[model samples]
Target: MKFTTLLFPAVVLGAACPYGTYAPEEPTDTRGVCPMLNTLANHGYLPRNGRNINENQTVQALYDALNLTPDFGRFLFKAGRLSNPMPNATTFSLDDLNRHDLFEHDGSLSRQDAYFGQWSRFNQTVWNWTTQYYTSDLLDVQIVANSRAQRHTRSNLTNPMYSLSEVGYLFSVAENAAILSILGDKVTQTCPKKFADYLFTNEQLPFAVGWKKSALPITIQDLVTTFLAIQSATSFPPPPPDDSSVDIFN
Candidate 1:
């Protein structure tokens, strides 16, 4: 039988966010850093791959870890930092990476996948101003994280492929921007077209028979083209001074 998973469809997306009081506090003081680390202590997620991070008091020591936002942390955790975020979105559930089938309930994603996955997750997932993991996806990211997940400064995603998660996140960002723009909201200037192209090409790129293809709901090109059109509308292209001054046949 052909096998395909209904991984993270809209129905699943509609599920209530499992977030509890985990509603992270504002990134003010680093006093409760240990508590954050403790959150993963019993899980042994730290000090792996020869980079030993003290599970107890290290997160707090990072007082200089500027821009330490909660969503950022969640991004890391899901992608395989703090922990492999959707470690097994491929196999089991997207709820918990640790519980994912990507690895043993015993741990995170497998090594081969981790190697590639982490590379993409760090560099691309966060949408850095310059660098990008051009043709990667979440599963691609999990490939690397499953292998070499750690708290090392270098381990931070530095891969050079584009990930679908990055594309999806960009779509969400664009959608949010479009909503704000409709309501006359101030929007940031960010061109994710390159990112969209990167992900699209990768999604449509051929893979070996044994490898998994991208998880897009449709063909890669169509999806990319559709989103590009949507996002392009959000770009701050100069409009004619007045609608009356515009021509429909331009």
Candidate 2:
């Protein structure tokens, strides 16, 4: 049954966004830890209510909005599904993804650590700290990677309950990779810093900044290539060897 999911087709190039428009406003609906996911819900790519999102909705939302391949989109949905507690659940609400450390992790570039008690809210000061490394209008792989590494290191040192498992670390790096691949030129491995700023702060796509979905579908391989680049460039101290706690939320 699961194999049939691979048959889902990618969105056609230049296709109109079927999810309506990218409208940013204060959300009264359930939201999640990931800014990009919340932005998708806000833009109506996912249900604005952010509830009961099925695999089809998730895959289509990703493909239509970000030009991601359906397979890659499905992989993300499956990962989020790990957070849902319902037995044999095939759907998930955005809030269900709030379960820590599935993909959401500590040392977020924008959100506060879970220990701070407002882990889900976007903190402007934290965002400012992360963006300080982006001195220019453009952000390259190394810049993004280093910024993430620095944030992780800081969190490890200051947050008394800090914890990041291998899974958390990988997801953190992948989040950066997603931003670079979706907003910047995949070949050049760079994107306009303003585009990222608008997305992270306002929870909106930076269409006004001349950002458009990639012409070529963003494959898993595209993300993998960027992920590897960021990972290789990142230089941060390892967590304590005895740090066995697995749960984390940013």
TM per model? 0.19, 0.85
- Candidate 2 ranges with C-alpha deviation above 4 Å: 1-18, 25-27, 237-250
Cα-lDDT of candidate 2: 0.84
Cα error, residue 80 of model 2, in Å, equals 1.9
All-Cα superposition RMSD per candidate: 22.0, 9.9
lDDT of the candidates, in the order given:
0.27, 0.84
Candidate 2 lDDT, tens digit per residue, 1-250? 5654544442431143346576553457888788888899888889887888889999999998888899999999998677788989888988887777666789999998888788886899889989988877899998999889878888888999889989888889988998788767778888999999988888888888788888988888998899999989988766577645765552
TM-score of 2: 0.85
Who wins the TM-score comparison? 2
**Which prediction has the highest lDDT against the true structure?**
2
